[model samples]
Each structure stands twice: as structure tokens, then as C-alpha cells.
Target: MNPSHSHPLRIGVFDSGFGGLTVLRALLRELPQAEFLYFGDTARLPYGAKSRETIARYAVSAAEFLVRQGAEYLVIACNTASALALDDLRAALDIPVLGVVETGANAAQAHSHSGDVLVIATAATVESHAYATACAERNLRAVEKACPLLVPLVEEGWIDHPVTREVLSIYFTELMHQSKAAALAPDTLLLGCTHYPLLREPIEQAIPAQIRVIDSAEVTAAQVAAAVHAPQAGTPAAPRFFATDSPAKFQRLGSRFLGQPIEHVELIDLEALEAL
Candidate 1:
């Protein structure tokens, strides 16, 4: 059943860091009336290197925190959490949970007539083989590339720099070469990392014209809107932001991802939850 929101619906969005703001940015467009509570587990971030158990524990705590904040639906905006702990999250949370990986694979199936797609994500997300597994479930073949440098570059706010473009070029060149070597004809290039949406322009410039670029944030927002059919507009409510680390730093860098200034960022301690 599709999830429809009532007026003033509370939607919770969680990420290991500020990258998930892109997802929240898209969701705000799709569900303008719904109130948003975004949590950035910045203190325990770089979740890519954590064990599955640890990742699940951190994600579950974040989910529970959102639920406590009256969130009726949860969006796991972090690719690492979504890749490694989606099933655990879904099983543990009562609210419906949506992840970038599944939404991305669904998009690949819809966009690729050749049933082949290429994914560029962080090392941890690619290492999980979650995208590949999700695509195969839809009868689509996926080639996953671990672009570790892209995240830091994005966080550094060097999105349009020549160096960023060159890095994108190098990654895409190798990805294309690898795709051809595997005898796969891919027509879709799916951005598996949330931060990737920020570098979309440069990344697009580096890819072949024939390949369609799928923004996971965009697709996830569309899917949420489709599932939860509510009024197109609701009362204008300022989004509440939470960070486990420095609120000032989060607001400083998060403004870049959200394409606007972020204000009223609240710092909250999540140490107790981490032990859970």
C-alpha cells in the first residue's frame, strides 16, 4: 500500500553526515507541506569503514530518535547505512524505511533497456555489493565503481573545480573501459552516493552522452511523493536540523548541499545511543 501523509506529516531523514541534505532538499520539493527532522550522525560518520553490526546499531539509534520526534516515515539517506543496514533497519523500525540503493536499482531497471547500469559510489557502499545485488534482483546487471575521493572533494566544496572534473573523468574512463571489457552495454549511470548529486554537473560532463544519469536523491524523492500522496503544499514550516557533532560546521557546509543557507542547527549528544 502506498503511504499517504496527513497534513503536517513528520518525515525524518538521517545520514552519516551532511550529504543526506540533498535527499532532504529533494524531499522538500516533493512534500512541501510535510515537516522534516534531519539528523546527521557526524560524530560516528565515515560509516563506510564500520562493521555491519556497528552500522546497524548506529542506524537503528538514528531511526529511533526520529521516531521519537514523531516521524511517521524514515528515509535512510546515507548510502553506507542503506547499503549495509537497510534490512536491519526495516526489521527494527515500525515506520516505513526507504533506502537509496533499492530506489537506485529500481530506477536502473526503468531507465536501462539494455538491462545494464554503472554505479559510482563510496568505497564502503561499493564494497557491500548492495547495488549489484539489488540490480540483479531486478534482472539488471550493475557495475560498481568505488570513487573514494569524490566525497571528500564534495565536502571540500570544490564541485566545479578542474581537479574535480579530472577526477570524475578518470573514474568514468576506467568505468567505461571496465564495462566494455565485461561485454556489458550500459545506458544508465546511477549515482549511488548522496554527495554525488552535488557533483552531478561535472560527472555528467565526464560521461558519454548516451548514458542517462540517474540521481538517486531525485528518484527517491519522486518515489516518496508517489507513495505518499498528500496535498502539493502544506503550511510552511522551518525544517528542524540535528547534528551529533558541531552544529556550526554542519550549517556552514550543509548550506552548500541544500543550495541555501541553513540556520538553527541544534547540537545533540548521541553517545548514549551509540552504545545501544
Candidate 2:
């Protein structure tokens, strides 16, 4: 579908929790004038722990809700949902749906000359090997490592803490060793989690200076903006925020992710939609 710049675009960003706010933050910066509808399925958080079928069902419901709200474009901002339910979402929705895994893989493909890339994400995403498959399709070799502790550390508001850096140091040390043992000279590191963007500063500092770090949220936003055309100047509309549960937490943590105040958030009942 051709995204025309003739009018304001209603873009939907969906995630299982507040982490995906980083993607919306990037989108807001890239297309500040466009309308945004963000939904966090906090009622059923940690989609990584769910089965493939359940994940597909939950994601499709979120996509349907956004489409009904007049979302012309859909951005699956959750790495777990993107890894497991992207195809289901595209089949279920009639609009253009973009996922982070593919975008991150594309970025790696473009940045790598050695055809070897490194990915660090949650345990569930790493187990899915979605990044590996996406990289393979682009003729890139990828080594995926699960930094299971980083998510909690980020959520705990320890972005620049010494403990966070220590954990990251260990993860990077192990990742580099693993990649070398695999006989892959990886020159690019892909942050496969939306929450990882918040830790980009520390991550970049921890990784080798020569390795190019790719943030999935930033890359996805760049791709969406490129596809949707340039931003326009007008009285830009305030983004609409929704969460299946915990509007307060969404607003609180979301403000941190967006790097600005999140004025209000609406609580949604996606349970009814899931049963539909």
C-alpha cells in the first residue's frame, strides 16, 4: 500500500508492555505530525511466556482493535509478538504491518560486510530464533544471545547503574566469545528488544567501539518514516495511549520511554475482543 502524504496518517503501535514505548518515541520524533495510537496489552504481559497459538490470538486482537480505531499502518513493537505472530497479524490485518525483527535484520544486512551479525534480546526471543531466520533470508549470519537479566534491570530504572553495566559487560563478554567460537566475525550488534533502546547508551559503551550497534526501535521507526514520507508541520496531534491494564503504570513508565510527559492513558478491555 502506498502511504500518501496528502493527509494525516493514523499509525498503531502495539506491545505487551511499556517497553514498546521506545518504538513510539522514535516514531513520534520521525513523524511528529502524524496521529499515533499506542496499545499495551499489560493485562497479558510477557507474551514471551505464552504459546505460539495464544500469542497469535492475542496479537490479532490488538491489531483488530487498532484497525477499528482507524490505524492505516501497524507497527508490531514487541519483539516476542514480532517473532511469533507477525505472519498471523499480517494475514489478519488488511493494512501494512511492520515488525521489529525483520527491520533489525534488514539493518544488520545493510551494515555488515562480513555477513556475520550479533543479536542480544530476551530469552524467549532468542529461543524463537526469529532474528536468525530473518538474517538468513537477507544472506546474513547471526549469533543470538539471551540477556535475560537486562530486561529486569532496565525496567528497574537502572539504565546507568554500575550493576547494570556489570551485567552488560558479562553478557557482551560471553556473546563475543560465543561468536568467535562459532567462527563468525560479527561486526554489528542488534538490540533485539524494544526496551533495549533505553539501554543503548550503556550498550554502545560496553560493546567494542568498532561494532556498530543497531537499535530495533530506531531502525523500525526509520523504515516506517521512510515508507510513510516526510514529517509535516502543523499543530501536531497528541498521541492516544491505551493499555489493557494499569493505565497509571503505562503513563508513568511510558513518559520515561517517550522522553516526554504522557498526559493520560486510556484503559481498554481487550479480553472481550479476544473472545470474539
Candidate 3:
């Protein structure tokens, strides 16, 4: 849908947790004048461990809530939900829905000259095989690795910590070994999880020089910007923030991902919706 420039566009960005703020951060760069409604389903986070049905239910409820709040577009920023419930979200919502997995794959297809790509994401995303499938659809062979610890480390504000760097090194080493074993020459490394972008610096240091890293948040935002047309040169208001639980903590840690101080985050109760 072409958003009218008469007023700021209300774009909804949904994530299992605040990590998706990275996507919002990128979106702000692409469409500075657009109004973003960011919802963090923190109460039911780690959608990675839940069953596919459960994840879809949680994500659909979140999406519906944003739509009710006048969201013209929906961006599924959580990798787990993007991997497992993207189709469910599109089916449940009338507005346009974009998932990071597809965007990441699209970026990988654009960057990979060797037709092989490596994906690093949360365990649930790896289990879903969404990146691999998306990449395959784009005719790019993808090797997915589940780096579960990275999420916690990133949330702990250890983006450049020695331990985080070491962990990244190990994961990249294992991914390279897997790629070699599969007899595929990988030219691109896709950060399949939103949290991974926080560690991009160390991640680049961990990988080979020739292999480029694709930040899913950046690509997803770029694609969304392209879809919604260019950003207008106007003073955009601060984004509206909502969280299922822990408004205080969300405000605290969310700032790290958003790269700005979030003045306030309205606490939302999704229990009634979850019950349905």
C-alpha cells in the first residue's frame, strides 16, 4: 500500500522481545518520518522453544493488536516468529506483512557470488530452516547454524566482550567446517537473528575477509523503505513503544538496540488475547 504523505505512516514492528528494536533502528534510518509502533511480546518471549501453533497464536495476537492501533504495515522482527509464523501473520492480517527471514535471504542472494551462504541464528530459527528454505527459493544454498548463547550474551550487553567474541569465533569456525564438509563455497554470512546485528563488529572480525556479512535488520528496513517509498524530509516524532511485560526493563535494555533513549514504553496486557 502506498502510504499517504499527508501524515506520518503508522508501521508496526513486532518482536518476541526488544531485540527486534534493531530492525526498528534500521527502519528509522530508511523512513525517518514514518511513525513506528514497536511491540515487544516479552511476556511470551523465547518463541524459539514453543510449538509452531503456539508461536503463531502469540504472533498473530500481537499483529492484530498493532493493526487495531492503526498499523498500515507489519514487520515481523523476531526471527523465531518470522521463521515459524510469518505465513500465519499474513493470513491473519489484511495489511502487508514482511518477515526478516525473507529479507535476509534476499540480501544474501544479492551479495553471494558463489551461490552459497551461511546463516547464524537462534536454535528455533535453525530448527525451522526458514533461512535455508528462503535462500533455496532464491537459488542460494544456505548452511544454518544455531548459536543459542549469542542471544543471551547480547541481551547482557556483551556485544564486544571477549567472551562474546570468542563465542562468535567458535560458531563461525563450526559453520565454516560445515560449509566445507558440504562442499559449498560460501561467500556471504547472513545474520539470521535480529540480535546478531549488535555483534556485527566482532562477527566481521570472526569471519574470513572475503565472506561478507548481511545484517538482516538493515536489509529488512531497506526493503520496507523501498516498499513504502522514500522517507520525507520532515521532523518525525519518536516511535511509540509497547511491551507485554516489564516496561521498565524494556525501556532500559531496549535503548541499547534502538540506539536512543526511549522516554517511555506503555505496558500492554495480552493475556486476554493469548487466552483466545
Candidate 4:
């Protein structure tokens, strides 16, 4: 059912870190009529290396927080959470929950003409084999690599730094070598983490041009647009941004992601999660 134009739909987006802002940016671009509530768990950032059980717990808490804020639908913008916690989240939330993994996997499958795909993500996501599972389900072959340091590098805003380039070379050399050794170079490389999108240019330069890189933000945004109930006309809703810590930093970084200033970012007390 379409949402009436008189009222904007409230969509909640959550991430373990600032990376979720990338997904939120795309969502805003695709669905300008909707209002968004973004929560970045900066205190517990980088869920990539955490245990599956731990990631799931954190994800559920974040989802519950968003729901409590009157979110009608939720987006798990963190690939780590999507990989390890999506099913459990879906069962727990009354509203429809969307994740980046499946949407990204679909995009990779569609663009990968060579039948070989490479997935680069955090340790947790790579270990979860979320992309591999999705590819297998679609009758495709997959190779997964974990770049544990990439997130920190991106967070430091070093995507264009010389050290970043050097690190990319080191990280991607193995994948390139493996593809060559397998006699099936991957035609597509999936930037399985949201933060990886910011490193696209460097990553692209480090890899062969024949290999296309896919980021889930765009595809996920399109899916969100399709799934949202249309907003009521003339209804304007403002976005509420929240961070577990460093509200000012979040606002600054969020403005970079959103392509506009985030006038206000509230600091959330995630310690409350323990009580819950």
C-alpha cells in the first residue's frame, strides 16, 4: 500500500559505525519524501571482528532502539550485522527489515560476467560467508577476502593517502594472485563493507580494470525506494541523527556522507542498552 503524501514514512537506519551514513545518503537521494532516523553505534564501532553472537546482540539492541523511536521500517546498513544478524532481527522486529548483503549479492551476480566474484569485507562478514552463501544460492562461484584494517583507514579519512594506496596493494595482491592462479579472474569485486565505497577509486586502481567493483549502497537504496510506502503529499519530516558518542564528529562526518550539513546530531547513551 502506498503511503499518503500527507505524511512522511519514518525509516530507521542503523550501523555499527559511521559507514551506515553512506547507505543513509543513498536512501535520502532515492526517497526524498521519507524521513530517516540514523543511529551510529560509534562506541561499539567495527563489528567486523566480533563474534557472531555478540554482533547479533548489538544489532538487535540497535534495531529495538530505532523501533522505540517510532521507526516504521528498519535498514541494517552494516554489512557485518547483515551477515550475522539479519534473520534474527527480521523475526524480532514487527516492521520489515532490509539488509545490504542480499541486495549487494544480487548486484554482484548481475554484473559478474566471468562467473567468478571476489568479496572484500571485514573479518566477521567474510567469516560469515554471507556473500558466498548468497552466490551459491544463485549458482555462482565466490572468493572472499577479509580486510580488517580497511575500516580504520577509511575512518581516518586516509582513502587518498599514499599509505592507503600501499595498504591496498598489499591487501589486494593476494586476491589478484589467487584469481590468476585459479585461471578465472573475477570480473567483479564486491565492496562488501559500506565504508569500502569511500575507497573505491584506490581499490579500483589497484585492481584490474576488467574487474568491476560493486557497492551495496546504490542497490540497497533502490530496494528501499521500492519497499517504502509512499509519503503523504505536503508532509515534511526532518531527519534525526544520533551517535553513541561524539555527536559533533558524527555531524561533521555525516555531512560529508549526506552531501549537506547535518545541523544537529544527538549523543545517545548506549549504556542504557545494558539495562534493556
Candidate with maximal lDDT: 3
Q: In model 2, which runs have C-alpha deviations exceeding 4 angstroms?
A: 1-7, 230-233
Model 1 residue runs over 4 Å out of place are 1-7, 273-276
Better of 2 and 3 by TM-score: 3
On residues 1-276, what C-alpha lDDT tens digit does candidate 3 reach at each position? Answer: 664556678899999999999999999988888989999999988899999999999999999999999999999999999999988999989999999999999899888899999999989999999999999999999899999999899878887799998888898899999999999999899998888898999999999999999999999999998898534766787899999999999999999999999999988889966677
Could you tell which candidate, 1 or 3, scores higher by lDDT?
3
Per-candidate TM-scores read 0.95, 0.96, 0.96, 0.92
Q: Distance from true position, residue 146, model 1, in Å?
A: 0.4
CA lDDT scores, all candidates in order: 0.89, 0.91, 0.92, 0.85
State the RMSD for candidate 2: 1.5
Rank ordering of all candidates by TM-score, starting from the highest: 3, 2, 1, 4
In the range 161-258, model 1's lDDT, one tens digit per residue, is 99998898899999999899989999999999989998888988899889999999999999887776555555767889999998899999999888
* Model 4 residue 270 lDDT score: 73
Residue-pair clash count for candidate 2? 0
lDDT score at residue 189, model 2, on the 0-100 scale: 95
Question: For candidate 3, which ten residues in a row score worst on lDDT?
Answer: 1-10
Worst 10 residues of 4 by lDDT: 1-10
- Candidate 4 lDDT over residue span 173-263, tens digit each: 9887776777766888898998888898999999988888887888899888887765635555778998888888888787766667888
**Compared to the true structure, candidate 3 yields what TM-score?**
0.96
